[model samples]
Target: MSLTKEQTQHLYHKLLDMKKELSGEKKETESMTEEVGELSNGVDNHMADHGTLVTDRMTDQTVREIDRELLEEVNHALQKMKDGTYGVCEKTGQDIPYERLKAVPYARMTVEAQADMEDELETDAPSFEREFHEQVKDLSNKETVDQKSSQTYEILDREQDSK
Candidate 1:
């Protein structure tokens, strides 16, 4: 079902409110990212504590990245609202359910489309558990090689001693 005039107005206001909040948060994150400094690039004189600067830069970059992504979503939603296509699924051109919109106002697809995408992601990528187990196996193989190398070294040492 399509949204009524009242519902559309309501959602528009909600989107604006969310956009304002996200923009403010994005500004804060950007300032923090700037303060994180250019330790790697040698732009800032962080010679006193290079380690702490690197750690802080990594953490700030992560936060800034999150904020930038959210800001992009919020901006896209605002543009869709301006284009009179808000609350409509971009994939199927169907009116997205209000419940889903309420949960994620910036969503571009209907619940079914989103579920299909998630299923694809699950099938296309190796799970974290599987990757972790594979890494563990590799580490164990390295350990076994190390043990054999140590044994070979000991055997050579014994031969030299007997000579």
Candidate 2:
């Protein structure tokens, strides 16, 4: 299934809104960084001033990261729209429900797939750590399989057995 003209227009508007928001955030981050740099170059500040500076810098970093990620997502969605593949799940290759897309215009995964992925990522105490470990484990498993496959005689023997 594909998005109708109305739906596409709605998504376009949403994309515009997101772009505006991201632009504003980028400006704010830049301004904050400039202020921080100027303050750092100035004479010794009070404890409160230093604390506020640290907090502002941290917030700026987080906002910039979020803006960057959102911009990438919006770009991907725009590309999909151009290719006539918008509203489709990247993982499942199925049309994502209209409501879901409306709610999250930058979504790349279907609801089910997103939930499953989230659950998998959150199964451990530290979700990011768990996700990293899982990725490493997958790479290791692939390497082991490739090593075994490099033994051509063993592979041929296995193939003959299967036949």
Candidate 3:
């Protein structure tokens, strides 16, 4: 079903709000150096403290990346709105459901189309990688009565024993 004028306007405002929020959040996230509150990069601190700082920095970076991606999506949605194509599924050329649009204003595909695309991506994995994943799953499901009777079980036992 096509979006009503009110629905389109509602989604447009939602996208704008999301864009503003994401942009502000991206700026507000403290940088590693700012968060340190120290004169240097923790060189004079305990190794564990330094490690924690590194981990914190990595986490902050990941958050920023996510915010950046969301901001991009919001901008794309805004552009689509300007182009008179908001609420339309890019993949299937269908009018995206109002409920889904309400939930994810920047969504470019319908839920079913998105799931199908994800399934296609899974199937598009390299044959060797898929085979390796299947092998791992199969091994995980199999059991051996005795470690000595199964080479896989023996190796796993050895690794566990060493650990």
Model 1 clashing residue pairs (backbone): none
Question: What tens-digit string does per-residue lDDT give for candidate 1 at 1-163?
Answer: 9778886777778777876775674334334346445445565565666666666666567556555676798789879888888888877888898888877778899999887876776677788754544433333343644453544345557879999
What's the ranking of the predictions by lDDT, best on top? Answer: 3, 2, 1
Misplaced by over 4 Å in model 3 are: 25-44, 126-163
Residue ranges of candidate 1 with Cα displaced over 4 Å: 25-53, 126-163
The number of clashing residue pairs in model 2 is 0
Which structure is stronger by lDDT: 2 or 3? 3
Task: For candidate 3, write residues 27-57 as lDDT tens digits.
Answer: 4556666756663554566667757878767
Residue 116, candidate 2: how far off, in angstroms? 0.7
lDDT against the true structure, each candidate:
0.68, 0.74, 0.76
Q: Whose TM-score is higher: candidate 2's or candidate 3's?
A: 3
Name every residue pair that clashes in candidate 3: none
lDDT of 3 at 134: 46
Tens digit per residue, CA lDDT, model 2, 43-127? 8856787678777777567546656777889988988889888888888888898888898898898999998887876774495
TM-score for each prediction? Answer: 0.57, 0.64, 0.68
Clashing pairs in 2: none
